[model samples]
Target: MDNTRLPLLSTETPLRADAVRNRARLLEAAARLSAEHGAAAITMESVAAAAGVGKGTVSRRFGDRNGLLQALLDHAEQGFQASFLSGPPPLGPGADPAARLRAFGPALLHHQRANRDLYLAAEPAPDRRFLVPAGRLRHTHVAVLVRAILPDADADLLAHTLLSSVDVVLVDHLLRGHGMSLDRVEAGWHDLVDRLLP
Candidate 1:
């Protein structure tokens, strides 16, 4: 993937140094609350109390509960994005497209599993689903890889299909509802990729 061509996933305006620190502090507090109690425990008031800030500050930083949750999810996604976009080896830029594509599914599954609660909580409405910056980035990365590996394929649609196979909601359902192991889910990803390759 050409890092230069990637979209800026964050829509927020740049903040001053202290404002950036304050936002990070708030997100950290929210994450701690989620870790300790669960996503439901992370309200504006709760985060405010945890971060030793007033409720108004939380409100100003993140418009509402949903916005706060989205911001928190974005915060968590940054590391995963960095890993695939610029970090070393198979998941990153140095490896072949096929290898990167193969590595993406398990990495995504693990990431979603790690932050399942926040993702589930912040799941966007169906109409606006694909508009999320993180989702767009994932799709773009996958499409780029697919286009490279299968030059004649419809990379855009193929990318969506591939991503849909490992979507967090579906994976969560398979895990919690149907009693599937994470290994099985990951194996399924490898199988899908194997079948797709020549």
Candidate 2:
């Protein structure tokens, strides 16, 4: 499937059959609507109609728009995690932690940009509110390498700094205004990470 972000649903356990179906319908509808009209155009009623299900089903499954966005974010996060943990060599498990952390940002930006509507709609009230878990995942993933290299610098801070180097605002600005190419962005990130990590 051409998923921008993969399933970030709860991994606590399996969901009920009906819930599973409803959830699937919701995602399909959200993806389609977000693509056509952008994230703002996707309403509960609209999603329900598109899914061929009841509005109540969508509301019950996701609570409200914010809740639905959160669920979608979770799914995307889970998909990202699952892929990195096992998908491929550079993006997955086989690369150096520091190197991998540097690589992840551009991929994430591209991923987010592709699903612009869903991403914009799902942005948290404050970045800290939603980015915490995602940050945690990236921080720890890089911390492993930090400990191996510096071992003296605070790994947590190092991770945070490394991550901040790829802020979307900066990326967007660089790309749109400065006419920076993706390869340049990726190369810049490489330089940024190398300097930040040490």
Candidate 3:
């Protein structure tokens, strides 16, 4: 995938230093609230109370609850995106395509696990699920790698299959309902990748 396809960070837009600090403070407050209580517990009022800011401030920052949730998701996903996009080898650029493909699953699993609540809470409706920017970015990345690894395969479909195997909802089911370990799920990813190899 083209590097241009990656999601832009909120910080990309210029802001006064105090505006930047205020945004971070608001996001941090929301994150803390989400972690401690639940995503359902996060309201502009709650975040404002937590951040010691007024309700108008929260509204001005995010507009509404949905906007706040999306911004928070973007905030959280950016780090993971950066790691895979530009960080060191394996998950990043330096490793061979095959190794990078192998690394992607575990990295994604950990990222999702760490942000499980945010993902589950922000889970889009069925129709819009795959259309989200972050999801699209992942699909493009995997499809590009799949094209490199399996020249004759349906790279787009294969990428979807690989991603679905570790999807947040499924992973939660495997871990919570089925009593599967993260390591086991990660191993399953490796096995799936290996089986796809020529």
Candidate 4:
């Protein structure tokens, strides 16, 4: 179906603000629904139903199923950043760099646990020849914090390797698949950091 069928973006330029809104509403609903149910159970129709919009409206807003899935992942990433940047320390800021970085991995693991569907939906296909590159800005963020603890260390590479440890899939495998608890993960993180640092 044509996006034009849903609603125009505006009167003058032919774009519909209402449709834009409906799209955001659909994503919101999709997040909630996926969290409550599972990603496999989430459907465009379900999101539309929850958003109080037509399925066509949902399609117009997101373009298709892949678009909906990508949007959900985007939403989850934004939340992950927000939670880490501002939620609370030791997850957020108030803690020392050692403590902050120490908390970062576990906080991310916990975040993934709570938002598993969003996380799973966002994961890229494994066939890609090259791995996802680290975002320089985020690495800079980690580097700044890590540098404070180990002034002579290569914060860049450390952040690169260590940041990956926070990944949910890895945590899920190590914990659920291995029968480990959150505290075990947390302790393990501290031990690694100590060995790597000083």
| Tens-place lDDT digits, model 4, residues 116-189 | 76565566677631254323444666788889998898887888777666666777788778998878877777
Residue-level error in angstroms, candidate 3, position 69: 1.6
Q: If both were scored by TM-score, which would come out higher, candidate 2 or candidate 4?
A: 4
**Clash pairs, model 3 backbone:** none
**Candidates' TM-scores?**
0.81, 0.72, 0.81, 0.76
Candidate structures ordered by TM-score, highest first? 1, 3, 4, 2
Q: Cα lDDT of all candidates, in order?
A: 0.92, 0.71, 0.91, 0.73
**Model 1 ranges with Cα > 4 A deviation:** 1-15, 52-56
Count of clashing residue pairs in every prediction:
0, 3, 0, 8
lDDT measured at residue 178 in model 2 versus the true structure, 0 to 100: 97
State the lDDT of candidate 2 residue by residue for 145-184, as single tens digits. Answer: 6676677888878767766666555666787779988788
CA displacement after TM-score superposition, residue 23 of candidate 2 (Å)? 0.8
The local distance difference test score of model 1 is 0.92
The digit string of per-residue lDDT tens for model 3 on 1-198 reads: 676745454455555567779989999899888877878888999999999999999998899998998888898789889988888989999998899999999999988886788899888999999999999999999998999999999999999999999999999999999999999999999999999998
